[model samples]
Target chain A: QQPVQSPQAVILREGEDAVINCSSSKALYSVHWYRQKHGEAPVFLMILLKGGEQKGHEKISASFNEKKQQSSLYLTASQLSYSGTYFCGTELIFGNEKLTFGTGTRLTIIP
Target chain B: DAGVTQSPTHLIKTRGQQVTLRCSPKSGHDTVSWYQQALGQGPQFIFQYYEEEERQRGNFPDRFSGHQFPNYSSELNVNALLLGDSALYLCASSRQQISGNTIYFGEGSWLTVV
Candidate 1:
């Protein structure tokens, strides 16, 4: 099943911060975060495995809640380059090695 | 190493026509996955190929088929295309154990069905 993302879209100032959430009805084995610029491919940000662990890269970080079957991506001090569409991909324990993605969240950073 | 590469960056086809898109996996990668992303939506898994075999598939229709070559290159073929099939087709590649790890995606081929 595909995951559900919150705040379909968000607008933030250059220095503002935001958090995007991804939740699924099925138990997830791992969660992946990717950002896609306009007319560009989706770029991998980071991944969060089961066990409710958190991983971060630069100003982008993500946390996975195994019990809740949800994950969240936190963008700290967002920059102009962070403007793009963010997608959360989920891999379920019973899924057949196929990663399903959420609807997507559009993040627009302005000066 | 070169990342995932896709051919025919853009194309236009008529309804009932057939189309084929090609993809070459990254160096040293043995797995290839195909995805279709509609406007304003996330990428939807089409199918996955590993070891020159179809390992996994999504909920796509029977009209959608794919093949992987011995060189790790892949091709996605859609027969009797419909207008709704117009979207960006992306190819992703990873290692053998594609359980949960980084999967690189290509720039994608924009297919337009009239």
Candidate 2:
């Protein structure tokens, strides 16, 4: 099942912060974050496992709450290059190898 | 190292026709997965291949099929294409053990059905 993302779209000024949320009805084993610029492929940001771990990549970081079946991505001091669509990919079961992505949250960063 | 690579960066086909897309996974990766991404949407998994066999599949219909070769390359074939079939087909690759592993995606093949 596809996950639901909050704030379908967001506009942020450079040096500002923003958060994107992803909620799934199904229990999750792992949560992956990715960003795709216009006309490019989805690029991996980080992954959070079932242990409720938090991982960071540069200015971007994410937290996975297994109990809540949700994950949130935090973009600190957003940059112009941060403009793109952010998607959360969830794995219902470990080793199942299938990742169901969320609808996506469009993030726009302006100078 | 080269990441996942897809063929026919763009294509156009008529409704009711068929089309095939190809993908070569990243180096040192053994498992391949295919996903369909429509405009303004996230990628949806279609199927996964491991050891040259179909290891997993998503909610896609039977009209959508795929094959994986020993070299870990894969193909996605769609029959009786419809306007809705127009989307970007992405090929992702990772280790056979997938869980917790980073899956890399290709540039994707864009298909347009008239």
Would you list the C-alpha lDDT of every candidate in the order shown?
A: 0.91, 0.91
Residues B1-114, model 1: lDDT tens digits: 899999999999999999999999989888899999998889999999998999989999999999999999999999999999999999998773544566789999999999
TM-score of each candidate structure, all chains considered together: 0.96, 0.96
Residue A62, candidate 1: Cα error in Å is: 0.7
Per-residue accuracy of model 2 over A34-94 as CA lDDT, tens digit each: 8999998999888888888888888998999888999999999999999999999998777
Candidate 2 lDDT over residue span B52-73, tens digit each = 8999888899999999998889
Clashing pairs in 1: none
Cα-based lDDT at residue B113, candidate 2:
98
Native-to-model Cα distance after best TM-score fit, residue A69 in candidate 2, in Å:
1.5
Cα shift from native, residue A66, model 2 (Å) = 1.6
**Chain B, TM-score, each prediction?**
0.96, 0.95
Candidate 2: pairs in clash: none
User: What is candidate 2's TM-score against the reference?
Assistant: 0.96
